[model samples]
Target: MHVVATAGHVDHGKSTLVRALTGMEPDRWDEEHRRGLTIDLGFAWTELPSAGTLAFVDVPGHHRFVPNMLAGVGPVPAVLFVVAADEGWMPQSAEHLDAAHALGVWHGLLAITRSDLADPAPAAAEALAEINETTLGDVAAIPVSAPTGSGLDDLVTALDDLAGRLPQPDVDAPVRLWVDRSFTIRGSGTVVTGTLPAGRLRVGDELEIPSLGRTAGVRALQCLGRPVTEAGAVARVAVNLRGVPADALHRGDAVLTPQRFRTSDVLDARLDRTGDDPLPQHLMLHIGSAAVTARVRPLGSDTVRLTLSGALPLRVGDRGLLREPGRHRVLGGTTVLDVAPPALTRRGAAAERARILSTLDGEPDEHSELRRRGIVRKDELKRMGVPVTSRPVAAGWVVDEKLWAELRSRLPDVVARWRQANPLETGPPVDVVRQQLDLPERSLVHALVSPPLAIRAGRVVRDDTAQVDHLPAPVAKAVDELRARLAAEPLVAPDATQLAELGLGRRELAAADRAGVLVRIGDGVVLLPESIDEAVRTLRTLSGPFTVSDARQAWGTTRRVAIPLLQYLDRHEITERLPDDRRQLR
Candidate 1:
């Protein structure tokens, strides 16, 4: 189905054209129809042989009502930018175009209405030239008169042709249904109407009211006024929710997939100065269906930091635009940097700029999305325009390549620091590394690190490189003393306490063992590999081969030392243990 919205200056025949094509009144409010002006969002649907079926959002064209228009146009991909032939392009018409472009609406057809009242050819040509300079310059424009139905068929054909060319909508991502209009039903609960960007919504589906922080169930679903069990992307649908209040929602609110989207107030964007003038530091920000005052801070050259009024969870790369209400000028466009921006006062300009630039320009395609949005859900990243890779172990996701590189470089540095500070320890502990890098523990081991380092079974190691640095003073002393002490009396190996006295504790000893500085011959008994070699030689020379008792007496030790020493020799394949507990070379 094709979803399109009507946008233009006030009283430009957008509503009249909608009524003529769909035979339904787009003006929902009694005051609007009585006044013959569209103050709120109006919904109508038409069926065309070429386009099949199309839903229309007649957005308010007045400057004061542009916010309402944006809410209606937010999720739709195509639009009917209506302009009266007599008026040509007015101030509000230009603002609507800017809003459409900022919201990322690319495909559209221009409808020059009221052609009977005035010649539309020249005006339509001028409007077309203005639009083409922007993203929608190549769109088809049809001149029509709603009062006389003049050129309506030609307009329908143009719309049908545009609809046919639209890329197929992805319904498999997270559900983001922006509420353009909401009301309460007597028997059912609150009902919301808007375009579905992606994901499927079915009866009994739980949707979270982001502005309300509450979850509601889908009691019933309708598409184009027909009852249905489910609705997919690119469809205009009305959802009856189970337990939400009509008062709790507004035009800017959204019903989204739960446990996935989050809210933030900080946005990073690229501002396009409308008339060759940079946007002032303070201006109003209009996005989706809501408008709020925002303070802008330009970074480097193209990026800007936006401090918003309320918490808005916007994920990285959410495309939006900025405008000043009093000025009615396009400040610039922006993608989300940090939805919840850090405290600006506490952060210096350079830091703030870096944070904003990082979100806007850095890592456009590497790490999975980092921002949590209120309207979009977990699965939406893959469903939207983002490119994600899917696997059996993990679902497909969006990532910023530059972020991955930064992480890869920094992660190993953190691990190296941890390992250097702890010589007696096995590589850096997983939890420690996770906290240092601010990365999830599940992917910690698998996370890429520069020099290709990794933690293997709690032992940190450079993938192909062995541990190389000399032991620290304390650990080094312990290693030297233990080796000297073992050589002086190979029969009696010192326990953990003995090592502790020589500047090593159990933890340090364990670390040394992992580092291969010392080997444990038995419980609480350590043997330097060098000492073990000497003991094995002595036993092998004595009587050619010896029993456990003979080796014990020859080494001047008890069965404890003799037994482990013989076992250690056997393990190294230096000797074989016989049935009578004797040791001999194979």
Candidate 2:
């Protein structure tokens, strides 16, 4: 299905033309029908010969309700611009044209309404010339009188041609349905209607309001006023939400897939000023059915930073309009460059940021964006409409693959240097590595050092340098002397004072123990590596359970050395400790 919104001055026969074409009343409110002026949005659909099914979103044309008009046309891709032959062009016509142009609506049909009252040729020519000045370019114009039904067939044919040329909606893209209407039904609890330009909505799919962070489920779905299990893009859909209240959702709110979009109040955009005048500090921003008051800060000649009063779910390349608050006249058009912009608080930061934004204006690819930002969340990239065509280097984080490769290549050397400086530590802490690499996320550092370097007990250690192989020559000779002395007198171990004189301190003794050259039984007591085996062999020669005194007599060692050895053997499961402090083989 294809949807098109109406645009023109008030009393230009926009509603009348829609009623004649679709044979359905476009005005839903009695006040509008009685006053013959559309104050709110109205909807109708018809079947065309060339386009199959087309939906019409009839919008109000009064200056007081221009916000309502924007709500109707912002999500719709095409427009049906109306003009009265007798009126030629009016003030509202120019404003509507400016709005349509700023919104990037290029596909349209021009209708010279009430042509029976005046010559249609001259008015059609003038409207075409006006449209040519804006982004609509040259559009097909038809002279039609709703009362007489003259030239209605040609208008339908022209619309059919436009619909056939409309671009196909991306059904696989993330859902961002702007709710233009929300109400409650008798049987169904809450129903919200909007144009689904992309993505799919199913009966049981979970959706969220980006600004509010409120979640709801699709209990039912409707498209073109008919019930359906699912609805695709480019169709007007009414979703019956299960959990959300009708009062919580407003006309400007959006329903989207959870986590696919983010709400942001600050935007970095490219602004094309309609005139040469400098923009005001405050203006009305219109985008995606939302009218917000925003503060504008010009970054460069064509770039700006907008701080909105409220958050909006916006993406890169989205078009919006900035209008004066009182006059509501469009000052310029905007193309979103960055939705999640950095805060410019440093000295000369705006100029530097503007320079950076100027580089991003050319539509950099995903890799270039990641490289510039150093790190980005997956959801943030999706919200910016960036395509993730390749796998990320880390989970939920995207880094420049080239940068990751360089960091990975240097990890081993970095770890080796860190170990050389801090030999007593097992490895460098994870935070230290992250700081050294100047990475924004710790997960990226872990990913880069995963295979060649391993994280053991929360420290980064290289696989090749994990073991302490060769100590200093002095420590190595001291370890050999200690081992030879323990081998000669297995039960007699050196004390701390004697070992300190030999230059074998606790650190060197621990290193020797790790290297399997000595066994540390207690504080300052070192034994040969095979001391446990020889002691166990000798203990078996004794009878049943033995006491600490019996083990000391059997090993010819003092009670201090004998007690810790029995405990170590018990810990290693070589012997069991009894309730009376006796030991038995296990």
Candidate 3:
């Protein structure tokens, strides 16, 4: 199915052309028929020869109804731009074209209506020339008289070609159906209609109404008035909802795939046109049938910050239009850059933010996004439409490459400073390091640990350097003598009795281990830092599969010291423990 929006001047025969083509009335309201002016959006559909179904979202063309026109055209991808042959180019014609052009609607066919009243050749030529200059590119203009049926067949053929050429929609994409009309049905519950640009909608599908923090089930689905179990993209759909009331669902409300979108009030966008005059303090932003009042701040020559009155479920690269609410004039189009923008609080922040926005081309690349947000949740990047192909630095969290490097570098200094300032203590607690680095969460600090940095007894340590260098004079003297003794006797670990005699209690021993002064095998057996490596070297000379007693003899240590040391090596994967109580190098 294909959907197209009608854009042209009022009384330009847009509705007349639609009526003739579809054999259905395009105007729904009694006021529209009585006044002969389209006051709101009207819908009509017809089955074409080769095109399955072609739906027309008929829009009002008067200056007062420009917002209604924009709302109708916002979600549709293709258009049937109309112009009156008798009047040629009109004011509403230009304004409607601007709205469609700003919305990135490039696929279209021009319809020169009211051909019976005057010569159609001039209007067809002129309107085609005007539309070709916009994002609508080039379109075939058909001069048709609805009353006389002149050129009506040719218009249908042109429309069939346009339908065949419409861009394919991604059915696999998450559903975000923007409601254009919502009302209660007598027999059925609430019914909401919108253009399903992409993604599939199925009966019984539970979709989200983000603003209400609620979910609504798809009770029924209809396309072109035919009930169906499911519908795909590029089709106009009316959904019967089960949970939400008709009064609760309004125009501009969206039904979305749950958890697929992030609702944001602040946005950074790329403007299609940055005119000589700056944008106003406030403007109405229209996208997907939504007209929101937004506060604007120019971030750069082409970028602006928009703070919406309420949050909307938005993604990067989504296109919208900004309009002066009172004038109903479209200022320009907008391409969303960042849905989750940082707060601009400091001096010169907006200037710096503009520089960042300029570097982005609106495509959500992983490197560019991760590089911008140093530390972020994996889901946040996904919700913002960023593809995270690379592995995360930590579980459920992604860190920028440069930021990770900075964290690794700064952590050593932070731990060293903490140790130096408090000699009796181990390194700072994990929570302290998290706050000191201003990390988003506590676990991120653990992912930042690298070489020369280690954790001993659940506290951070500088493994390569013995930071016990800052120990008290008396303790330092005692530890130096013990180090010399262990240096000579590589694996004869100090017993608890000997440690107590040297005034080294559990706290002092724990501090020494965190400082890399010695390796504390459990059960009060302490060895020099390099004793494990020395034992591994000696064991390598023995048989491939060696006994516990063999390991004890190789290290020249007692059974107690050797058992715990071997277990530590096994835990670190330095050695493998055999089923037969034997050991071998891993």
Candidate 4:
């Protein structure tokens, strides 16, 4: 996508050149028409051969209006640096260049205007040399006259050359529009315009008006005096927003994809003073035409922690330069650090500074950044125009592969330590282990927790009492004695009292029950498989169906013992309840 911004001093003939190229008046403001100055950002577009029609952002180069210049240059990737042949290398010209350079603009062409009034050679050479010294230094130069149309062909050719080499903006990336101007067009409702960073906008496309905290529909689209159905990246688009009022929209308000980006409270940045001015501990920050006050605390030497008053959704690797309070010039551009930070105090200032510096020291790569930042939703990366594959890695943080291996290796050690520390207890809870390790993602806890230390029944347990081990010596001997007693009297099983006599503690018996070691078939009775089978045989020989009292008498047991046994059988569906209190089963 090719978007060219017009730069140079005010009245250096930027608007005139735009008019000559597009054959349309970009200075549509009534005041601009009367005062004869480009007060705000003016946009127009025209088709160049093979490169297609390109949009041009005419920025105000007036020294006092650098904010307007930022509004224009914030979204465009390329620029048209204008310098009049009669008045070359003016102050505003340098300011505009600085803004563009801080914004990282490339693929620009030099347009030296008003050739008819002076010998264009000297002024053009000097102006071209000055531009070359800055970020736009390497761009092609063309000297032109808006009236006589001198050098118009050369100017067009230079733009075409730059357009051919400009990087293609990914239309599939997240949609973001930095609103440079907004107004009410007749019968069009509220119209807002700016460069669409990526993706397309159709007539009915719904845009989230972020400043208003609401969504507005695209009612219409117009570009360069022609109506288009859809506008793609790098195109200057006038959108008649439905449902949003004129007052709700303003310059610096962003139109973006819904829920794609999130707001941030703390920002780790790299900043420098614009001039020889002493760096203060606090300053103002300007990014994408938006300005806010931020407390600046330097980290070590290079990085700074910007604690903002309110949250602004920013991606992990978004690059933004700092601008101090009341200053029109740039501080420096820095990739973002932690978007979320705990509120810090003066006492912890040194620690916070160290953390910011450490985060900035890592190479700006996506994998490292996301890992360092913890987790990134697909939408956040999309909103910042950062490709998932090329995402920036936050420096000075461990990668997932190494982190996972370390976590796995540490689990066994953690379990052994827990066992030693809680000698009387079974084990620690899963959450306790997770907290101790300080896992990055909550999902990582699930990934790291495994067998031996953790076991799942109805719920996860960490205690040693829940473990599966051979019975204790006394409990094992008790079980063997009970089995022998039951084998001799196959029709009867030992009661809990008798089992207690065999030396198993109450807790130990309960643990055995939980482990399915001892079966409890009836109340106040303990039974093994042999005892249950012998009782069932005796009942079958006695009768096909029998009353509870008759069974108790035939088994030579009291009603208390016989009734519970009968109920236990009934509960297990071994014997079905019948009419008149009789019981029977095949």
Highest-scoring model, TM-score: 2
Off by over 4 Å in 4: 184-191, 202-229, 240-242, 272-276, 325-327, 337-364, 370-399, 419-426, 440-443, 451-454, 458-586
TM-score of each: 0.69, 0.87, 0.81, 0.77
> Candidate 1 residues 130-171, lDDT tens each?
889776768888999989989999998888888888889878
Best by lDDT: 3
Global Cα lDDT for candidate 1: 0.73
Residue-wise lDDT of candidate 3 within 1-586, one digit each (tens)?
9999988868738898899999999899899889999999999989888988999999999999888888799899899999999999988898898888899888999998888899989998889888988998878888889999999999999999999988899999889999999999987889999999999999999999997898989999998889999999988999999967659888888999998888999999999873567679999999888889999999999999999998889989899999986765789999999999999999999999999999998888889988988888888888887878877777789888888888888998999888788776667788778888999877787888777776655667666755666465666777788888888887888888898889888877776776667778786888877887888889899977999999898778889888999998998898999899898998
The TM-score of predicted model 2 comes to 0.87
Q: Each model's C-alpha lDDT?
A: 0.73, 0.86, 0.87, 0.69
Candidate 4 has an lDDT of 0.69
lDDT for residue 368 in candidate 4, whole number 0-100: 56
lDDT of 2 by residue, 537-568 (tens): 98999899999989999999998789989988
Of 1 and 2, the candidate ahead on TM-score is: 2
Point out where model 1 deviates above 4 Å: 259-262, 336-364, 367-586
TM-score of structure candidate 4: 0.77
- The TM-score between candidate 1 and the true structure equals 0.69
Candidate 3 — which residues are off by over 4 angstroms?
Answer: 463-473, 476-586
Worst 10 residues of 1 by lDDT: 390-399
